[model samples]
Target: MVQRQQVVMFEIKKASEAEIAERGDLADKVADALARAGFAVHRDVNDASGALGAMAWADPADDSGGGVFVRWLIDPAFSRAAVQSVQQGDVESAAFKHFSTVTEQMYAALLAILTSAGFQSEDADDDMSPYTIRVKG
Candidate 1:
């Protein structure tokens, strides 16, 4: 049987004007970290507002009992240049191509980046939920 595991979740909030400038760079770093830790990362965007984001997941081929996943959403307030950068696309593609089952390292790296940037952790309670990219097997 296939079971899904929640490794980590970040309730990312909208970025302010000044923080928008750094969103692209931070996204790139997170994507790179996920790739290095062995995940198939996918770059995504919000259709309505065009917010950028990425998702990474553990591969099933490795015979791990459960799956691990991580995803994040960039603040919609970010500029178009940062939201639609060629570098971001390339980095995301490269990360997506890396498929391995090692999930702990990816979780640690991703958690570090998000927490360092002051992104909120997921709320166990529903009433306090915030904007986020949720990942699950």
Candidate 2:
């Protein structure tokens, strides 16, 4: 039997028109918060097409094949932030367990950071996507 690979995504929703209008500024603040929390942050240079920005960071300890790749993107149209996580290699590999473990830890950390920064959020419903967290600001 083939096991399907799973990708986890979290959406940070903007609550009001004022928040949406200042998405770029909000994204910058989020990036700064992530950086301060020790996540490697890079501003997306190709944002001219309307995306606010993109960021990627990984577990510093997992330099090998065990690490998961995480990305953050701010959508200009919706003024929402999406955080995605995917394993680096084959889904069936033994390292998948490690990937899941690390991914969960990263997600928890991310949620805590965002919430402590004054955003409202909730865990995804069982009927919704697996391991998803929806955040609202």
Candidate 3:
């Protein structure tokens, strides 16, 4: 079977105009936090292929054949981050299931980390459809 990637988008909810004005700095703070938690931060496409803004990858030591990638969107009007799993080679049903389970665990852990870093975050939907996280600034 073909492997499919799972994505979790994080949208920042600005608390004030000052927060909105400091979106770039906020993005950098998030990147720093993730880096401290063992993610490799990439600031350019050259650092990470096809990346439009900042990108980060979970440590290779945590890879279960599929690693997690995080893209930090620095747009002033709509700052956000997107976390996703790297698609792996085609595999059997059992392997695919294992990958999905592991990916979910990784997502959960990431959410916890973000929240612990003082970002008020929650899943956009109760059932987690679309896998979006609303982060309060």
Candidate 4:
């Protein structure tokens, strides 16, 4: 019964030109693998001047008849609690809790998305690390 949702932010890692060439088909590989694994993910490769990042988004609104009940529960919970307030519509939310269950599991989701894309990552975060990436449109 859901219609729309927001994608969480993600980052790039270990992707150099030589690496992409060696794994030239990685972009398609990443996208397809994620889809098959039940995450409707998207990938991006970008660079401006000397800065760069690779990012992806999983379809947070998917309801593909799996009936597992967990993803169904998690989707609306996250959107209502974390995403809806920030979509520039009206209500403003408070600061994100980087250590909460939502953020913690989101980190796991990011790991899954990135690894599928052939990016090797240790992908750690302390209090000093960013809480969310906010992948640009």
Clashes of each: 0, 0, 0, 0
Candidate 1 lDDT score relative to the true structure: 0.41
Per-residue lDDT over 21-75 for candidate 1, one digit per residue giving the tens place of the 0 to 100 score:
3444444554566556554456443232443344633323222221233444344
- Cα lDDT tens digits for candidate 4, 1-137: 98888899864343445544434354455445546667644343322222212233232222321110111013434445555555555344452342255555765675555555555533433244344322111
lDDT by residue for model 2 (26-72), tens = 55666676677776666553333453322522222221211122243
Better of 2 and 4 by TM-score: 2
Task: Report each candidate's C-alpha RMSD, comma-separated, in the order given.
Answer: 18.2, 15.5, 15.2, 16.5
Q: Roughly what TM-score does model 4 have, to 2 decimal places?
A: 0.33
Off by over 4 Å in 2: 1-20, 45-93, 122-135
Weakest lDDT window of 10 consecutive positions for candidate 1: 59-68
Tens digits of lDDT, candidate 3, 20-106 = 345445556667877898865663434544443335332222122112234342333221111212244444445455545554665
The whole-model lDDT of each prediction reads 0.41, 0.47, 0.49, 0.40
| Candidate 1 residue-wise lDDT at 136 | 28
Off by over 4 Å in 3: 1-20, 42-92, 124-129
Pairs that clash in candidate 4: none
Best model per lDDT: 3
Q: Residue 94's C-alpha lDDT in candidate 3?
A: 54
